[model samples]
Each structure stands twice: as structure tokens, then as C-alpha cells.
Target chain A: MAEAFLRRHTPELFGLATLLVCVLGFEALIRGGVVNRYIIPPPSDILLAFERVIVEENILARCRDTAFEMLVAGGASVLVGVPIGVLLYRSALWRRAMEDWIGALAAAPIVLAFPLFLVLFGRSPKTIIVMGFVHGLAPIILKTVEGLASTRPVLINVGRSLKMTQSQMFWKILLPSAMPIIFTGIRLSWTFVLITIVGIEYLINLGGVGQLINELAERYDLPGTYAGICFVILVSVLFFLALERVESWLQPGR
Target chain B: MSISEKTSLAQEPALVVDDVVKRFGRGTEIVTAVDHVSFTVRQGEFVSVIGPSGCGKSTLFNIIGGLLSDYEGAVKIGEERISAPHPAVGMVFQEESTFPWRTVIDNVAFPLELQGVAKSERMDRAHHFIDMVGLASFEKAFPSQLSGGMKQRVSIARILVSQPKILLMDEPFAALDEQTRLLLGDKITQIQQELNQTTLLITHNLTEAVQLSDRIVVMTYRPGQVKRIVDINLPRPRTSDVVGSDAFGHYVAEIWNDLREEASRGMADSESAASRRATHG
Candidate 1:
């Protein structure tokens, strides 16, 4: 009975225990003067700073800004990449010619092209959104093509033998068959979009949590900087939980 | 009138494969899979096509089912030449083709859904076929949640719900164990007899063919052509126990007699290919 309970609540119990250890260790290290408090604030100080950032600094508004950028980038990646992927799947010539190039593009230093994006979009939110979208698109496109191409020939034969139209075949058979892999692509794209969004905000001093962290570091407010970093963690956790919910909704009993 | 008499009244050819020749490769290296294959399946008749491995029995099946349109000659259903898939023909493949996402009834109702049938009506129709296949209790079960034989039953129900005149089954029970194969074979025979479905089965198991078919068409080795047409006039309402009878054993032997040489020749070719690979590798 105890083992079953432990197994059932293992993640929550372990996560909290590890978190407590880290927090207490950090506090003890600071009090014992083993580490410089100016550089690494104790967890309690960071938590106090977190309260100040939430109440005084109004971090929620900046969170909304970051979220808006991510949504635009993530949405654009799906809209643009899926069609390109479908085209690649449909045309063998195009796929043969460009498949390797797509693989290369995914690993390319796409964010290094942010200056070009700035010039194109005039140093606005559009620049960061565009950077995030472009950086996220390659994985989505490659995965979609692979997903569609790797659909079982038997399923396609079933669709054809049932007298399904090309459109019907795509919607009823191909899309559903490719859904799990496509969802993987979407999740990967979300990761890339999240990273690009924060990185662009940090580099350009855009108005978001990354920019807040930069400002707090410049001001020598170590605790506030740690608090801002925590907000970043918060953002990541929110994204993960939201994706998990959507995944469960889309593929029940998976 | 009895069931056989009523079936004979509609004595039209349900499916006709006319001099169909399927080949692969280009230039001088071209190889024929099926050569000059001609046969007719009368309405409400059950025919089994048995052949050695790679004898193009499946290729012949694909041609008749409108999956391979590039083959030579024509396949016809009734009087119309078949170049594309028609609603009157349904196929159960050797592979597990049930969509893993859908439940038993949904997979079975898929064909009707494609025809724009209403949800309630299609469900009702699908339920009837599910019950016929003894899968009524599994109406809400996913394909992944079923046994191999049960999955095939779902595939069969899916095909039958379309109410096709011709049922093309390609080695549908080849993946199952011997016991499951025998039980499922008997269930298939019962369903076919009950519905009087016009079915053409491609199988390597001679006993299965003898148990289920009215006539078995045996094919030769590669570049397959009909080597013999063996009539199995066994008793009606055959069950799994029919295989124990002397008549079933005789029919099985007769098919084996025609098939033995072709099977050995195929084995010899494969052995030589393996030896060539072994030497080269």
C-alpha cells in the first residue's frame, strides 16, 4: 500500500523534496559566507524580490507581451510550414532537391539573421515575431513532410480503393495518419519559438521578462535578476502545461 | 426456394478478370508477375486463389480490386469495365488495415460516412454488421485494444458494412496462429454463407481454401497463370470441424498436388538468391 502510494505521487513528492533541498542549501551557503551574496541571492531573498516584481514591477503585462509574440510565431509556423511540407510530400522532385537543404536550415544560425529582420520590420514587435517564426519553421516543415511521406501504403490503398476523392483522402486518411508526428513537430516548433522570442527580447532590449532581467542585472539588483529568471521558468512551465493539456485533448487514450 | 436455388436465379458473372497481365521493370529485365490470367466469379460464389509465394496472386487480386490500374487487359464487374474503384467492391487486406484511432463501429461506418450518410443512420447500419461479425460487444473498442483475429473481424465488418457485391480478401488470416486461423476461417465461412457474399480469397493455406471455397484456382510459379481449377463440392454449412472429414482432406490433398511443384520451384529460386547474396556479401 505504501509503495503504491509512493509510485502514484512520486513526481510531486520528489520534485518538492528536491526543491526544498536546493532552497535551504542556497540559504545556508549565503548565511555561511561560502558564496558571494551579491552575485547569487538566497532563495528567500529571491522570493521577496519575486513579490516586488509581481506587485510593483507589474510583470503580468510583460508576460502578455511575450505570450502574444509566441502565439503569433507559433501560429505562423504551422500555417506556412504545413503547406510547404505538403508540397514537398506531393512533389518528389522538389523533395529530392530540397530535403537536405531543409535539414541544413533547421540547424542554421537563423537568429543571427535578426538584424535583417529588424531592418525588414523596422525594429518593432514584428522583428521578434518574424525571427521566432522563421527559426521555428524548419522543424515543422521537415517533420510534416516526413510524417505524410511515411504514412502506411496500406492506408493509402484503403482510401483509394474506397473511391475517396483526393481531398477526402487527405482529410480522412493522410492528415489523421500523420497527426502524431505532426504534433511532435508542433511541439518542437513551440520550443524553438519560445527560445527565439526570449533571446530576441534580451538582445534588442524588447519589453519582456528577458529585457527585465537585463535591466535588473545592469542595475546590480541580483535578487531582482533572480526573480526575473524565475519568471522565465514560470513562462516555460506554463507553455509545457498548456501543451500537455492540448495534447491530451487532441489524442485521448494515447 | 432454397438459398442455393435463389442464388442461381441471378446467374450473372459478378467479377471478370480478362487476360490480365501484370509486369514490373523496364527494358530487357522486365519480369511478369501475372501473365494472361482469366477467370470469372459468378454472383454469390466463393472462389479461392492459392499459389506459391511471389506467384502474383496478390497482384491479380489488386487488379480485380482496382488498386493496380496499369496492368494489361481489363477487370469488369457486371458489364462495366473497372478502371477505378467502385462502391460495389470491398477489400480486406492481409495487413491490419483498421484505423487505430477509431472505435470498432466508427471504422466499420467509415465507408458510409464517406458517402455522406447521416451519423445516426450509419451507426445503425454499422452495428448490424458488427453483430454479424460477433463484434457487437466491442463496438466502442479501439483497433489497438483487440486481438489479431478480432482486428481482422473489424476489418471484415468495415468492408461488409459497405454492402459490396464483391469481397476481395488477400490472405486475411495468414498472420494468425493455427487455432485462431481455423476459428476465424469458420466464422468467415458462416458469414459468407449467411450473406451469400461473392468473395475471392487469396491464400497459401490449402486447407483454408478447401474449407471456405466452392472452387479453388491454383496458380503456377512466377508469371502466374491458372495451373488448375479444383472444384471442392463439400457439404453445405461447413464449419471448423469440416477439416476433420475425409472429403475436406481429399480436396486439401488435390490442391496440394497441383501446388507442390510450384512451391518447390519458388523455394529453389529463393535458395539460389540466398547463396548468391552469401557469396557476394
Candidate 2:
């Protein structure tokens, strides 16, 4: 087991180690005046500024704003996308009719349409959050559809032979079998959420970590900006890691 | 003494398919998958369906198993007209049947759980069948962790936990190696003898059909219809050593001869389609 773990994760460990070395090297270069802090914030200054931000600012409020958006996006997409995916699967005619549209939405950049959305919804956090949801939702729907479509024919036959009701088949066979891919779509969903939230904050000035970064950068507080970036990176990594752990825990043998 | 008087859950032919027909698609492309197929599976009998691919043996199996209801005519389990999945009918399909998310124990226990059996009780019952199929050590392992034979075993164990009056197996060991096939075949025969549950297995392997079945039903190619049903007088507890025996060889020859003309006709049709596609392309 230990050997298997080492083999599976040696590259990840190498990456983390490499990142730590780069961070320390950057810090040393900045402190030694080999490079100016104007070029990039020193790690020490960034850490100190982050500590101050935590102590002074309502970091929780900003966090809550971002988190609330993510929650709303995740919950609403899971509810709406799963059924749409299943519906597309249950009928071939409906699947063919909607499939091209789903594929188009999944491929197109909903983020680029933010200006139009702002014109319609105005400059509000609700708009930012909904934009994040819209950006994140297409993949969830597509992946859920792909997952359901790709589930083994044998499992479907089992559902049929067992005389499982359509609902029972959904709850028992189709949904559970589709979960891994669907969750992967969910796992990938975070990427779009992070991008949408950060982009919106820069554009609309809603106070999230993204907005805080923008505000700090505007005031020439490079350290605060870097620190805010660090937090975003940390949260995104941790959020995905938490999701990975849950997916593995639910999947037997892992 | 009479067929009707003899019909019951415990002793009657557990599943009966009478003049059942199944067609795929419609209009000019209407393909009759199963054509007027009829069969009776006596309670505790191990009957096998043997035919070439596209012969609609699987379709017939599905009809009896109640997987497809869009077909014509009737299928009855004991005294009732079968229209839905009855828990008393357990099915073990090929290797892909086991759910990847479920452990060996949970996969086997699923039908029981759906039946509302308590978790602890279900696990206990599941473990017993798991042990019976020689998967005792891998109870907590997932389907991904198991080999193909092991996965099929888990499927078998799962089906048995329900103690269904009949077990419908669709080429359950076709994916496994020859050795595993022999072993699993013996295990299935043993289980049937012990439980005395009616069983109908559908397969194309003539040797496998010969070894595992007391009677074999052969079908023609597409627009498949039952060609002949041959009974084997071989004694029980069949092993791999029995494969080359005179009785086994005789059964194999009989089935091969019956299928030869259908096989040739199927090939001719296939060549014609290929020629058409070549011309069209």
C-alpha cells in the first residue's frame, strides 16, 4: 500500500517541493535586492500584509460572498443539470434535438458575454454569482449527459430485467453509475467558477477575494494583491482536494 | 399429472415462453429478432439456449426474464402472466453487470437492500453466497479490484441472495477463461442441485452448453426461431474431464450440424450486405 501510494503521488510531491523551492528563491531574490518588489511582491511582505488583512478586513464577508456564489451555482446546477441530462438520455429524438445546443454552450465562452449580462442585470453581486453559475453549468449538464450515456449497457439491462421502475432505474442504476463522470464534471466546474468570479470582481467591483485583489492592485499595494492571490490559490486547491477525497471515499477500493 | 395441475412455484416450470416474438425497428427495416419461440423451464431444471450470434437468443432470454415487454405473445412464471420484474426471478448477466461503485459485499447485497432487508442481515446473507462462490476474502473489494471471473462470481452471489425461484443467466461465463468457465459451470450446477431453483442459461458456446445444461435449445439465425431442443442423458456433477466423452461429443456434433445451415445462410446474407455497402460507398 505504501509503495502504491509513493508510485501514484511521487509527481505530485515533486511539484509541491519544486513550488516551495521557487517560492523561497523568489523571496530571497526580493530581499537581497536582486529583483525589485515592484516586479513581484516578496513572500515575507505578502504574508505580513495577508496577516494584517485577516486582522483588519472582514475577510469572512468577502469569503462568504464568494462561497455563497459557489454554493448557489453548485446546488442549482446539480438540481437542474442532472434532470436535463437524464431527460436527454431517455429520448433519442430529444437527445438529438438538444445535443447540438448543449455542445455549443459547453464549448462557447459564456464569460465573454459578461458585458451583455451586466447591461441586463446591472452591476450587482447577484449578477456575478449568476454569471459564475451560467459559466459553470454547461459542463455539468454535458458531463452528466455524457456520464449517463456512457454507463454500461449491462447495468441498464439489469435495471430492465429487475423490472425497476423508470424512477428506480434513475435512482439506483443510471444516477449512481453516472456519478463518477458527473462529479468529474463538477470537479471541473470549479475551474469555471474561479475564473468567472475573479473576472467579475475585476469588472464589477463586488467585494470578493478577486475584488480585494483588484482594489489592492489599484492602490499599488502589490503585497496585498499577491497575498490575496495566494489565498485564492489555496482555496481553489483545497476545494478541489476536498472534492477529490470525497469522490475517492465514495468510490470503493480507493 | 397434467401440465396445468402440476404448475406451482415450488414444482411447476418456473418460467414459460409461448409463441413469443420480438421485433426491432419498423417499416422496411423491421427485423424480427425472435420469431415464435416457445420453451418451458421446469422448476429446478438447468436448461441452456445455444445459438449463433444475431440468432436472438439473448432477446428470448430477456423476454423470459421480463426485461422486454414490447414483444408479442405471453411469458408466464408459474401461474402468472409475467409483465414486470418479479423478485423471485434472479438474473446474472455477463461480467459488466456488477456495479463499479459497490463492493463485492454491497453489490451482492443490493437486491436484498432494495427488498428492504436490514443492512446487517443483508450483509450476512450476502457473505454466505460470496463464500459459496469462493469470493469470501474479497467481500470488501470493489468490482474494479476483482478479475472478470471474480466480478461474475459477485454477480452470481448477488442474484442468489434474493433466493429467486429461477436464475436467468445470460452467457455469465463467456468472458472468463476456459479454466474459470469450467469451475464456474460446476459451481452453478452444484448450486442448482443444492437449491433446486429453476435455471435458464443463454450461450453460443456449444461445449459450454453441453457441459452445463441438461437440455439444449438451438435457434436459427436472424429472424431467429427455435430449431431443435436436445436432451442430454449425462449424469450430474459434470467436470472438465467429461468434455471429450462420447456423450459430450455426440451432443456437440448434433448441435453443430443443426447450426451449420443457419450459419451458412447468415454468412451469405452478411456478404450480400457487405457487397451492397461497397457499391453504395
Best candidate, DockQ-wise? 1
Off by over 4 Å in 1: A1-41, B1-10
Q: In candidate 1, what are the lDDT values of residues A1-254, reduced to their tens digit?
A: 99999999999999999999988998999989998898798889998897888887788788878888988998899999999999999999999999899888888878788888888897778998989998889899999999998899999999988999999999888887887888899888988898888888888888677678778888888998899888877887887788789877765545
Query: What overall lDDT goes with each candidate model?
Result: 0.89, 0.82
Model 2 compared with the native: what TM-score? 0.86
Kindly list the per-residue Cα lDDT of model 1 for residues B40-121, writing each as its tens digit: 8888889999999989998887888888789888899877888777788999999999887788998999999999999999
Q: Which stretches of candidate 2 lie over 4 Å from their true place?
A: A1-9, A20-65, A83-124, B1-12, B25-28
Best by lDDT: 1
Alpha carbon deviation, residue B205, candidate 2 (Å): 0.3
- The sequence of per-residue lDDT tens digits that candidate 2 reaches over residues A123-151 is 88777878877777777888888999898
**Model 1 - which docking category?**
medium
